[model samples]
Target chain A: MLAFQAGNLGAFQALFAKYQKKIIQFCHRFCGDQAMAEELAQEVFLNIYRGAAGYRPKARFSTWLFQIAVNVCLNEMRKEKYRHRIDSMDASPETESGKPRIKELCDPAPDQNELLEQQEREMMIQKALMGLPEKQRLALSLRVLNGFSYQEIGTQIRCSESAVKTLIHRGRQHLKELLENLYAGGDKS
Target chain B: MTCPYETWISAFMDGELTPQRADAMADHLAGCHGCKAKYEALTGLDQLLQSLPELKPSEQFERTFWKKVADWEENRSRRRLADWFKRGWRTVLAGSLALFILVFVSVFQGRFTRSLSPEEIILAEQMDVLQQYELINNLEILENWEAIAGEDESS
Candidate 1:
């Protein structure tokens, strides 16, 4: 950032090259739309570029980056508050296992049934996450999806670390209730 | 809600609980099926969230973003340049106005002062004796005016 402040354009590019994917991923998970997330990510970089001169090395650059990203996302979500589109879970995963999935899942290329099941579960989770209030959703996504520590999540969200833990806990409890209502044979609810 | 350590179950799922607290929670879960179910549900959600795919932007994301940044910087510089010009022009105009007012006031200050001051009035009276400046300036031409007019008439 100081390099960019010192007029090294390549430093700006280097920052973008290093963080574009992570930033886009964070925005996508926060907003749940690739195109909108891409736009938000662009806005974030523009903000960073505009504010480069004022950039103090307060925390990790990544943490600061996420702070800007989260602020931009919150603004975008405020503007689009009523436009949320829930990913429909018409085929919420039909699993008989007591646990959701024990082992970590990574499929380079899954068969069709596995793909369909995975897609359904992903959609259901997205829908559940959408039902959450924006702050809770952001906290939960940062913690669970992005794997940010509570302190870092607090930094991005402008709350205490303990508050972050509370947000995540409440967010997860709320999401579990939603998912269980949808998939745990309490579908009648 | 059924167990006292339910919050610990959440903290434990994230590996956030201290060892002593974690041991206590593990003991609670072992004796209580309901709390264990709650723990499973919480961890299940965590697992599902972690398993969700890491998303990526479109392939042109980098190119488009860099291009936008360049455009933004260009526009910002242009704006700064324009603002500099705006402020520069304003200062120039203000300076000119101040100078004009000063010159205007100065040109008339002696006249105004002579009206009210004894020294200026005496200086003005002494100077007013040489009032026909233009006549004195054209004295040589005026002395030969009759001869010049006669020559023109003859031509």
Candidate 2:
């Protein structure tokens, strides 16, 4: 980033090459939409490029990068279009044809049953993750998904390290309970 | 029953505790089944999250991003050009108006203070003499004013 700030544009390409996948995955987990994740990731990089002139190396580059990513995701979710989408998702797991989306998403494949099971489990985990309150979800994702420390998560989320710890703990507990309920419901049906 | 040490267990699982506190929590967890269960649950949850599949961008993601960047740069340049044009015209208009006002005021002032023509200069220099001549010509009329009024009444 500093090199890019010094007019070495190739340095920026190198940075992009290194962090692109991580950033995409982060957005994917945040919004639960792959296409939107790519879009948000592009926006994140655009902001970074535009803000390069003001880039200060006070914090780690990845920390600064993820900070922008988090803001972009939050802003997108705050938009009326995405807010409606999230509202529909919250209204029910199935918003189409009155069918369970989990089953609909998991089509049976004789050869890929294991892959199907893995995809199903991932979907359930993502749904539970989305069920968390925004702050908790952000804190947890920064910590668990991005492997940021409590201090880094606090910096990203604008809270105390202790508060971040508490958020992550509560987020984990909530996720556990949500998963349990989902599994129990699945078992019953 | 819930354990008070569950939060510590969560932090412990994350290796967030200080060494001394971590050791103490580890010892406590050995005897405390509930807190240990909480730790296990949190661990399982973390692992499950870590195991979530990685999502990759489409192959043309970089190409698309660079294209967007080019578009953004072009738009910004065009905006800067437009702003420069707008400001330039505004300044030019203001300057022209000021020059016009200055020219108009100077010309109006010059009309009053301009070098006098020969005829007007003579008129200005002899203006007191001209006034004296006019008074002399009207002296008779001024002196017979009462008699003239009486004659007109009789007629």
TM accuracy, model 1: 0.70
| lDDT per residue as tens, model 2, B1-155 | 67767778778877899999999998999999888888888898999999886765666689999999999999999999999897889889999999999999999999988998999889789989777987888999989999999999999
Model 2 alpha-carbon drift over 4 Å, by segment: A87-110, B88-155
Instruction: Estimate every model's Cα lDDT from 0 to 1.
Output: 0.77, 0.84
**Compared with the true structure, what per-residue lDDT tens digits does model 1 show for residues B1-155?**
35677766667777778899988888888999988988887887788887777664566677888798779879989999999897889889999999999999999997787554787677578775557666677898989999999999999
The CAPRI class of candidate 2 is acceptable
Could you tell me how far off, in angstroms, the CA of residue B4 lies in candidate 1 after the best superposition?
A: 1.6
lDDT for predicted candidate 1 compared with the true structure: 0.77
TM-score of chain A for the candidates in order shown: 0.79, 0.86
> Model 2 chain A — which ten-residue stretch has the worst lDDT?
A101-110
Write candidate 2's Cα lDDT for A1-189 as tens digits: 999999998999999899998999888778776657788899999999999999888889999999899899889988987766656654554424464434424335344667667766877887888889988999889888888999988888788999999999999999999999988887899
Give the per-residue lDDT digits (tens) of candidate 1, residues A78-174. Answer: 6744264323223322222222321223346667678667766776776677778888998887777767888898989999988988888888889
